[model samples]
Target: MTAPRFLQIHWLASYPGTLINRDDSGLAKRLPFGDAVRTRISSQCLKRHWRTVEDDWALNQIGPEMAVRSREVPEYRVLPALEAEGVATDEIRKAVVLALAQALYGDKAEDVSKRQALLLGEPEIRYLISKVSEIAAAAADAKSAGEAVKTAFKEEKANLSSMRKNGVLEAGLESALFGRMVTSDRAANTDAAIHVAHALTVHAEQGESDYFTVVDDLARDAGESGAGGIFDTELTAGLFYGYVVVDLALLKSNLGGDGALAGKVCEHLVHLIATVSPGAKKGGTAPYAFAEALVVEAGSRQPRTLANAFRQPTAARSEAAAAALAAHLSSVDEAYGAHEKRHHLSLQPIEVPNSSRIGLDGLGKFASAMASA
Candidate 1:
């Protein structure tokens, strides 16, 4: 088995809202990023507010699925089959987990099954399903059904702790929110990966218009559509901050020794970013607000890596990153303060009306400050 790889974390900061005007039929509205106009995408005008909850659900659901999908089998399809057999959902859940564990984890399935049995003792149905998983795997391998069942029970009973411990390693950070059992086996996991890919694609298409609308509405409000092209599209600096733990060991185990799979994943990542970002030029100086620099750190904070924890900062590495963040924020704060004094404009955050669809008006405060400077 390949050793675990360091987890990578980053963020994608977004501006949210939908573009109102349509230029032509069947065509998405275009907007500017730096100097050139590109297509606009959006999630919702209230996108920022939704980010808090959406990430929680999306990450939890997607993480485990991604891990299991590494081994492609029809694991998810087994859930209803177990239910049809009168097996309890709890057992069915466990059984499918074991099946996945056996397929992806190989010899490790036995111990993993036992640990799950104990943790979910009351969920008899789920546990039963889990038992079935082992049975199915053994059967698939040409073992007698009775022998497979026997081996599953024996392994589960004998090496319960081993199962639990391995669960921690296999799950990494996901264990915290979803518990350390094979929630979805390899097949189910593979299905989940496909689902995540689709969801991300949908998000990107929706998000483009959101950014465009925010900028355009603001521009129109300020009447900055001057012939001088003050509101004309131009390349603007953008950034991405994301955090995800890529399970290299899991990837290798599922994808075989094909090292290209990892690179393929990276390429797909770039594609996803471009798809989501509206301002991305068709290969010019227009840069998408996705990833720029790549840095991976070793440490398990789970759902969130050490970098995310650094947002608040407690540990040494975290503190270092935090210090940098604080310094940057401070510089921006100082600049804003100077502008407020010189322009005599209120620096206070004010609520703007929702219906007055004007983008230019929003920058009024900033424009005043700039003139004064």
Candidate 2:
């Protein structure tokens, strides 16, 4: 196997008076790491934000290359295509639903329900529609078309290899990065190429409870007794550290060796990580913040995370945490000589005592280098 190319990204972001990620108990998620309790944001939350950003980017930049994750494929994709082809309104729903079931479930198609959602891309939709149309064209009537569809898929079930070989189920970039699993059909599964670590605070600090009251304007104007509402919420303030790694070789394969698409994916991912904020309490606290410091590393060495730098925790501010992380990384590189290239971008004016700094302008260049690798 060829050595895999990897891109490692680390960032330090500070939020004030915010519950960036909450637990089931409605408290900010916290974890006991190293010597102190650190605020934690789950990888699931981060990936959700990343996927949302990627989907928007794909729609605006790439034009319909992103997949839709839904269970209503029969209604949204199949029915629409058949309708456009002049299939009768009444016959379209039953025919397409039956065709989809057979195409996806084979002999067990009857057990499959139309309500089950699946992660499908446009390519897969088009392929299914083509097969259904072929069966429809060959049939003498609607009833015959339905039977022909079932028979065709039953034969396909007998020869699973031929079915898979002819299936044009192309995974989109988001699916390629995060992956998908079809319980009904294992062949549709895509292995994820990107790994994200749960973000943790760089310092240990106790969270604060904000007790405030909201008054109904009409009640207050009408001279109602007492306050309209009173409530309390838990929030924390600290410098959070995030880490992510991308397997370039796997990403390339996921994009079907399309170098250009891979480049776009890398670029958008980097941009989102640097600027996007996964505000957990979006409407209430509105903790919209971006990374204060970002480091991107690309190399052939085994990927490493800087989470250990926070084992002892740092000062409350981001600058101290950023410097500590930079120092720790430098020590590791000196001892192991691992990284091939490292680049830094700081939103604020801060200096790492022992590392070279790259301006934000170099992000595009770094992303290009990562994609080409």
C-alpha lDDT values of all predictions: 0.32, 0.73
For candidate 1, lDDT tens digit of each residue in 18-72? 2222344534444443333333433221121111223322332333322222232
lDDT of 1: 0.32
Name the 10 consecutive residues with the lowest summed lDDT in model 2: 159-168
Give the alpha carbon lDDT tens digit for every residue of 1-373 in model 2: 1333888888888888898888899999988999999998899888877777644443235442567777666666776777778654446446656766656644455554534556666666676778776666566666777777767766665322233343222544456787777664666677787899999999996589999898888988898866778999998987899999888888777766666666677777777787778867778888878788988877788899999988997897777887788788878978987545777888666665444577655764676567765
Best TM-score among the predictions, by candidate number = 2
> How well does model 2 score by local distance difference test?
0.73
lDDT of 1 at 187: 14
Q: What is the TM-score of each predicted model, taking all chains together? A: 0.26, 0.81
What is the Cα-based TM-score of model 1? Answer: 0.26
lDDT of model 1 at position 221: 82
